[model samples]
Target: MLLLQANNVERRFGADILFHNVNMQIDEHSRTALVGRNGAGKTTLLKMIAGITEPDEGTISKAHDLSIGYLAQDQGLDSQNNIWDELDSVFAPLHEMEKSIHQLEEKLSSIDSTTDEYQYIIQQYDHLQTTFKEQGGFEYASKMRGVLTGFGFGEDMYDLPINSLSGGQKTKLALAKILLQEPQLLILDEPTNHLDMNVLNWLEDYLRGYNGSVLVVSHDRYFLDHVVSQVYDLDNQTLTHYTGNYSAFTKEKADWLRAEMKHYDQQQKKIAKLEDFVNKNLVRASTTKRAQARRKQLEKMDRMERPTTDDSSIHFSFHSDKDSGNEVLDVENLKVGYNENVLAGPLSFKERKGQRIGIIGPNGIGKSTLLKTILKKQPAISGSIKLGANLEIGYYDQEQQQLHPDKTVLDEVWDDHPEVPETEIRSLLGSFLFVGDDVFKTVKELSGGQKARLELTKLSFQPINFLILDEPTNHLDIDSREVLETAINEFTGTVLFVSHDRYFLNQVATDILNMSSTGITHYQGNYDDFVNETSTLSQNEDKTTIPSTTQTSSKKSAGQQSYQASKQNQRARRKIQREVDKFEQEMDSLQAKHDQIEQQMSAPEVATDIAKLSDLQKQLDECQQQLDQAEENWTDAAERLEEFDQE
Candidate 1:
C-alpha cells in the first residue's frame, strides 16, 4: 500500500526552477533516503511531501487516515511542560479515553441495574477499553522511556521543564516525541546533525526495525549507509532512484555517468560524420543527389543533446613547505577546559609524523577544547605539549572564527597572501567555487558551507606541515567532504583533528584517540577498528589489551635468559606479521563477495524474491561481521609489528 506519493512535483522561486518532474513514492514499510548536494531543493521537496507546503505544478497524495511525523532541521519543541509530560502528550487521546472510562465506571455505580442509560454507558465503556488496549495505552510509558533513554536522556532529566532545556536537548525531545507517536510515515530532515555516536547507533537500530515507512534527508553518509536501503537523489532539477545504500549508490552513479558519456560521445561522432559529408559533397555535381539525401536524413534524425553534468563544487589541494620531525607532537597529562573544570583529559599521547589522528567524544566533552589548547589558542588546565622542529601549523576552524565578517571573499584570500597578484588570488578563490560576483560577498553574508570553502582556500595558500582541525567536516556537504578527505589523505603532514563524521574519520584517520574527562585512550587504526576493539572490551570480562607503543628491551647483556627472550620476541613478531597478511587476504576476498551479494540482491529478477532477499540479507550481515573482525585482526597485527619495529 502506498502511504504517500508526489507526482510531477515542480517548485519554483521567482523565475528560477528549483526542481521539476520530481516524482517519488513511499510505500508501506519503505525505508528511503533523499540525498542531494546543498541547495538542490531537498528541503523544499521534503516540506511538500510532509504537506507543510504546496507544490506549484503537481499533487501530493497521502493515504486516507495516514499519520505523518515531520522533524525538520532546527525544529524544536516549545512547551512549558516537563520532558516526560511533553513526550507523554503524544498519547493524549489514550489518556482522554482512560479518563472517560473512569467517568463511565462512576456513572455505572450510580445508575439502576435495569435502566437503558446504564446499558448504553456499559457498552461505551467496553468500546473505549477495547480501543485503549488496541492503541497500546498500557505500554506507552515504557515506550516513551525507551525512546528518551535511547536519545541519551535519563530518568533525572525527565522532570526538567522543556523551556529550561538547551536547544539540542529540546531538539532531542522533539525527536523522542515523534518516535513515541509512531506515525504511519516518518519524515526526518538532517536528523543526525546533533546526534552523538551512541544516539546514532540507537537510532540506526530503531529505524532498521521500524514498522512504518521512513524518508530521511541527511548528509551523514555512515548513517545513511546503515539505515536506508533505497536512495532518491535530487539533482539537476530532477529525482533519480538507486536501489541500495550510499556506497552502492556512489558506485552505480559513477557507472551511469560513464555509460551516458560514452553514448553521447558516439552519437556526437555520427552527427559530425554526417555533417562533414554534407558540407564537402553538397557542392559537387556528381555527388549532389547523395549529399542531398544525406542532408534530408540528418534533418530527420533526432539529435541527442549532450548530457549535462553538475560540477559546481570546490576543487583545491593542500600543500606543505617541508616535512616535520619524527615526533610531530607529544601531549603529556594535558587537561583542557574553562573555569578550572577539566572537560577532557589528563591525556597523554604521541603523534608521529604522517599519522592522521582523529579525536572523538560526545558534545561538551571538549573535543574542540583539546584542539584549541594544543594550538595555544586557549590555556591548558595542566600538562605539557611538545612541538617538533619545522612544524608549521594549519588550522581549519569549523566555526569559521578565523574569517573576518566584514571582509569580502576576495579580500580574505588576498589579505592572507598579499605577495600574490590580484588575478592569481581571484583564480584561487574561483578554484574554491567563489567565482564572479560571489567573491565580493562579505564573509558574514556567506552560508556555512561557503565559509568553510573560503577557510579551506586560505589554508591552501599557507605552507604548513602540521594540521590541527576542529570539526573540519561540520558544514561541508557530501561532495566537499569527499574532496577534503581525498586532499587530507594525500597530505604528507601529521594531522590531529576532531570530528563526529564517522565516514570522514574512517577515510583519513590512521589512529583513533577516544577522549574523556577521565583520560585519553589511544587505539591503533581507523574508527571501525576503534569501535571493534572498544566493543570487544565491553563484551568480555577480561578486557583485551589494545595494541599500543612498547618500550625498548633493557637487557643488553647476552645471557641464556636474554637469548631465550629475544628468540621468543622474534617468533611473536613473525607470527603477527603472518596474521596480518592472512587477514588482509581474507578482508579482500570477503569484500569482493560482499559486492557480489549486493549486486545479486539488486538484480531485477531477484529484487522481489522475499525468501532470496532474506537469505541474502543473512549472508550480508554475516559477511559484514567477518569483514569487521578481519579488519580488527589486521589492525592488531599491524600495530604489533610497528611496536616490535620501534622497540
Candidate 2:
C-alpha cells in the first residue's frame, strides 16, 4: 500500500526555485534514501514532506491515519522528565486503559452477582485486556529498555534527566523515542551525525528490520548502502529515482549520464548539419524547396537541453616539496589523555613513509587525543614519539579552531602566505569554492563545510610530508568526502589520521590501527580487512588465546633452542603462507561467481522472471557465504604468518 505521495512539489525562496516538479512515493515497508550535496535544499524538501512546512506549489497526499516521525539533524529532546519516563509516556493510553480496568475490577467486587452493571463492567474489562495485549502493553518496558541499550544507554542512565544529556546523547535519545513509537513513516535527516561504528551497525540492523517505511537523508555512504534499497538523487533542482542501493545508484547514474551525453551529442551533430544546409541553401533558387523542408523538420524537432551535472566542488590536492625518511613516525608505549589521565594505550605503532594509517575506536576512546599528543598540542601521559628526518607535519583539526574567526576567508589564506599575489590567492580561494564576495565573508560566517574547505586550502599551501587529521570528514557531504578521499589517496606523504568514516577508511587507508583502552591492534589493511581479521581472531578465541607482544617476546626468549627448531619454525611459516595463498584463490573464485550471479539477477529478462531471479538470489547468497568463509580463512592464515615474522 502507498503510505504517502508527493506530486509536482515545488519550493521557492523569493524568486529562486530551490526544487520544482518533485515527485516521490513511499510504500509500506519501503526503504528510501534522499541524497544530495550540501546546500541542495534536502532539509527543506524533507520538512515539506513531513508536513512541518508547505511547498510553494505541489500536493502531498498521505494514507488515512498515517503517523510520521521526523528527526531533524542534531535535533534533541527537550523534556524535564527522565529518560525512562520520557519513553514510558509513549504508553500513556495503555496506562490509562490499565487504570480503567483496575477500576472496573474494583467495581465488580462491590456489585451484586449477575447485575447488569457488573456484566457491562466485565465486558469492558475483557475488551480493554484484549486491546492492551494487542497494543503490546506487557512488552513496552522491555522494548524501551532494548532501544535505550541499543543507543548505548544503560539501566543506570534511565533515571538521568533528558536535559542533562550531552547534545549527541540527547539526539540519540530522541531517535530512540521515535523508534519506540513505531510510526507508519520515519523521516530522518543526518541521523548518523554523532554515531560511532558500533552504534551505526546496530542502527543499520534495526532499520533493515523496521516495519514502517523510512525516508532518510544521510551522508554516511556505508550506512546507506546497507539500509536503503532505493535511492532518490536530488540534484540540479530535480529529484530522480534510482532502483538500487547507493553503490548501484552511483554506477547507474554514471551510465545514465554517459548515455544522455551521447544522445545529446548525436542530436547536436544532426542539428548542425540541418542548420548548415538551411543557411547555405535557403538563399539558392535550385535547393529552396529542400531547404524549406529541412527548416520545417528542424522546427518540429524537440531539442535536448545540454546535459549538466553538478561540478561546483572544491578542487585541491596536497603536495610535498621533498620526501620524508623511510620511517615517518614511531611511537612506543604512548599514553594519550588530559591532565595525566590515560584514556587509551600503552599503544605502539610505526608509520612508514607514504602510508595512510586510519585510527578507529569507539567514541571518547582517545583517538583525537592521540593525534594531539603526537603533534605536542597536548602532553602525553607517558612514552615517547619520534619523528623522522625531513618530516614537515600538517594537521587538520576537526574543530576548525585553527581558523581565525575574525579574519575574512581571503585573509585566512593570504595571512599565512603573504608573498603570494592577491589575484593568485583569490584564485586559490575560488578553487576551494570561495568566490568573489564569498571570500570577503568572515571566517565566523562560514558553515562547517566551508571551514573544513578553508582548512584544506591552508593545508594545500604548505609543503608538508606528513598529515595528521582528526575526523576530517566530519562536516563534509558525500561528494566532498569523496573528493577529500581522492586528495588523501593522491598525496605523497605519510598520514596518521583519526576517522569514523569506514568508507573513507576503505578508500584511503593502507592500514588500520584499532585503538582500545587496553592496547592497540594494528591490522595491515583497510576497514573491511580489519573487520575480517578481528572476526577471525574472535572466532578462534576459544581454541587458543592470541599472545600479546610482551608474551610473544617472552616466548621467543624461552623457545630459543637448536638449529632444527628454527628450521621447523620456518617450515611452519611456509605451510601457513601456502594456506593463505589457497584461501586467497578460493575467495577470488567465489567472489567472481557472486558477481556473475548478481549480473544475471540484474538482467532485464531474468528480473521479470520471478523463479529465475529467486534461484539466482539463492545462488548469490551461497556464493557470498563461501566467499566470507574463504576471507576468514585467509585472515587467519595471514595472521599466523605475521606472528611468525614478528618472532
Q: Superposing all C-alpha atoms, what RMSD in Å does each candidate have to the true structure? A: 17.3, 16.9
**lDDT (0-100) at residue 9 of candidate 2?**
96
TM-score of 1: 0.81
- Candidate 2 global lDDT: 0.89
Query: lDDT by residue for model 2 over 286-353, one digit each (tens)?
Result: 99999999999999999999888764688899999998999889999999898878899899999999
Error of 2 at 440 (Å): 0.8
Give the clashing residue pairs of candidate 2, or none.
none
lDDT of each: 0.87, 0.89
